[model samples]
Target: MGTVRRRLAGRALSGSLALLGVLLVVPSLYSPTREMAVADREHGSLLSHQWEWSWGRVRVAGLEGVELRDQWNPFGLAVLVVLLVSGLAGVCVWLARRVTWGHVLGLVTVGLLTGRVLTTVAERLGRSLGEVDQGAAGLTVRTEMTQAGSLETVAACVLVVALVLMGVAAARSTGRSTLPAKLPGTPAAGTAAAGPPAGRAGPAGLRPVGEHLTTAPVSFDDAGAGGGGGGADTPATAGKPGRTP
Candidate 1:
């Protein structure tokens, strides 16, 4: 029972941390500023010059300026998708209540890798948006991590810690099951190995108290010598006269 409680406690903490990381990822990962390129002008695409990504959504043009004032969640997208991928994985961990999901992690990482293929498309469209730059783009794209709670690295760290804790708890639980059947010097369970106390009957067969006699022993030698038992006497005197003594 104690071990169970401890495991549960550890899992609960891990789930909570994973949830927190996911929540953080819901906010803006990066804010991007883009200048109209010659090709864009020639093509008349008129895409939004500013935007940011969060909650698995995208904004462009007029939509881009909506939350621009929000210091922490400046609008951005692209490499910051790492936050989204990590966030999704964290959610899975929390839901499963487990930390040993290496497969899940690998799958998510592969997904992120595939998504990187879109980098070229984004860069061409002035999608300088990313997790690292954090808006060094001519002060035009600025973000504050404090208020928005979009510190990607910190959030990821918290999730990692949660995973570690859950794994440790699982390891301990497994160890308990693999322990020796019976420890040295420890009495075995059940009455199979138990024995009766001194003078007590054990494995008895027939007779009320087994096959023991209740009477005391007698000395046959003394009885034969006429020292401890009565017997016939003076037979010799009758046959050959008295000895006169």
Candidate 2:
């Protein structure tokens, strides 16, 4: 019963982690990790851009006067790889009805690293944009991350927390399954009561029994009857009877 319960709990945790992974992927697809704005000082026109990262693609959208450029960075690619692998692992775990600490750790690490990398990339992109020369055209560029409560950030946090919780649950289940079960009426170690008082007889003249013995006691009356029969047939008794006859 305990083993069954533990397996069920592990499966539940795996399912939860999978759900979290899917949720995390959704926000990554639609939410912009960073926003960029380019302005022509002379023309007074501002161009807004949004960068979104997903499993297989990177999206850049220009909301105003400039054309969006397609670009990829090493860091962005690495983050994408982690996201894809973690998402797939989660799905497999959910389907297989199993979960391990390694899976949980992978999910957690991916989540945390994704957030960190997003921040770092955003900062680097912002810096690079600020340094670009407009080539005699009065142009300025600025970049900023999306709001704190952006869906991507929220999803990443949720995924990380879910993985941590799953790991903890799996660990607890494993610990419980490995422990030995205590049987009913069994004394705990170091506290077993001393056996029935020494030399005290049990039911029907039986010796006091411990945990293992179950034999019935010998009959004292049967032994006495056998002894009397043997005495009646002794040599002296036979001679006396013959002489009287």
Candidate 3:
């Protein structure tokens, strides 16, 4: 028990160190756009502008427009979300067994898609709250929100596929059971088995009653003085050269 505890402790310490290392490494890899966006939120009024427009047309049932003209918080929020998801993915990978690598990988992919969806939600909320202003500088602006080049459409499809795969994999991993390769007995199938062999006991119960059990008592003199039959005999009965006495 002590040895197993020590091994687990060591592994946990190493995993923590690796996580700290990643915390130190990721920011250095971020793109300049992310940095500038973060800067805009902190030092500029980009975060002060958010706007949404709702217009109806005879041909269109519902048309919604969002404008983040000066909204810069999206960049910072995106970076933060990415960092968080990356850290989560790392932790998931660490906690996962090697045999479940595919499941873990799928989980991380699903998380990425979910994060993107969350980003879209945040942006939509910001726009709805009138945190931005919208207008055309010179040319006519498209007031309709059903543009095909929007990021939301891409994220929606990705999220749908990722969620379906995640659901399938998670169901298989949690809703079913399979035996290990070594044990070939029925008792090894799962936890719901009869008690161990009658004579034997598990870690929690009585030991077996057998010849291997020691029930005899020994006095100090008999053990120390070596006078009992259990120890060496006198010289006469010890042996004749190599012959048995």
Candidate 4:
């Protein structure tokens, strides 16, 4: 019963993590911390800018439309891959009701994804605060990550913890399932210490020969007396009938 409960809990956690990851992927996770206004020296106009990070793309918007759009950094790409792989592994584990390689894969995926997101956020925030960009006509602009990115980072951390717990639960369930069960009325460990030693006598009432032996009394004396009496009678009859001899 305990094992069954653990398995059910593991499945529930895996499914929940997988669903959360899928939902997070759908929404825009990254948004600019602050709007940038750059002065156009030639036109004397102020241009607005915004930035967003997606799966493998970094999008920058200008006053009119998209200004600079490109692929994400290698670290960001790796994070995206981890996120995708972990989500898939979680789903598979829940559906198959087995751990196997999925546990290790999910653990690695969550760790990498969470670590990358945290590092990236920290680096971006530090750079945005410490450095300044000097554009045309000495126009200075700085940007930092917003709450959306931070929230996503926090979610990634939570997902990693959830995956770890899921792995633990699955491992426990697997162990319980694989262990041998004791039969009814079977003695537990060290309980047979009082039993007989090997090659010793068994229980009472059982014999190797299987049956008891018996003997009958003899009558040698009676046989001898009857023989002597018969001999004497024969001799007396011969004496009485010897007159003709």
lDDT of 2 by residue, 187-232 (tens): 9876676546556755575544674554344333454336666644
> How close is each model in CA RMSD to the real structure?
12.1, 10.1, 19.7, 10.5
Q: Please, what are the lDDT tens digits per residue for candidate 3 over residues 1-245?
A: 77546544543443444344334323322311111111132333332222221110012121232232332345545665565466556545644535556455545644554565455445544543542323232222222223221334344444555455445545554544463655665455455466566545657664555646444553344454556674553332222355322
Per-residue lDDT tens digits for candidate 1, residues 77-134, read 5446664666466556545644666435633543343243234233433433452331
Cα lDDT tens digits, model 4, 1-245, are 87587678776776577457545543433443233445565565556565556444455556676476544566755656667666666566664656567655555665555565556556556656775566645565656555666566556666666667767766776687687798778888786766886558667887744345332333334543366665433322212333331
Candidate 4 is scored at a TM of 0.55
TM-scores, all candidates, are 0.41, 0.48, 0.30, 0.55
Better of 1 and 4 by TM-score: 4
- Runs of candidate 1 with Cα error greater than 4 angstroms are 1-4, 27-48, 54-154, 192-194, 197-245
Worst 10 residues of 2 by lDDT: 236-245
In model 3, which residue pairs have backbone atoms overlapping below 3 Å? Answer: 49-131, 49-132, 50-131, 50-132, 51-132
Where model 2 places Cα greater than 4 Å from the true spot, the runs are 1-14, 26-32, 47-69, 73-82, 91-149, 183-245
Query: Which portions of model 4 miss their true places by more than 4 Å?
Result: 26-45, 48-50, 54-56, 59-86, 128-151, 174-213, 216-245
Clashes of 3: 5
Candidate 3, overall lDDT? 0.41
Ranking by TM-score: 4, 2, 1, 3
**Which candidate, 3 or 4, would have the higher TM-score against the true structure?**
4
Q: How should the candidates be ordered by lDDT, best one leading?
A: 4, 2, 1, 3
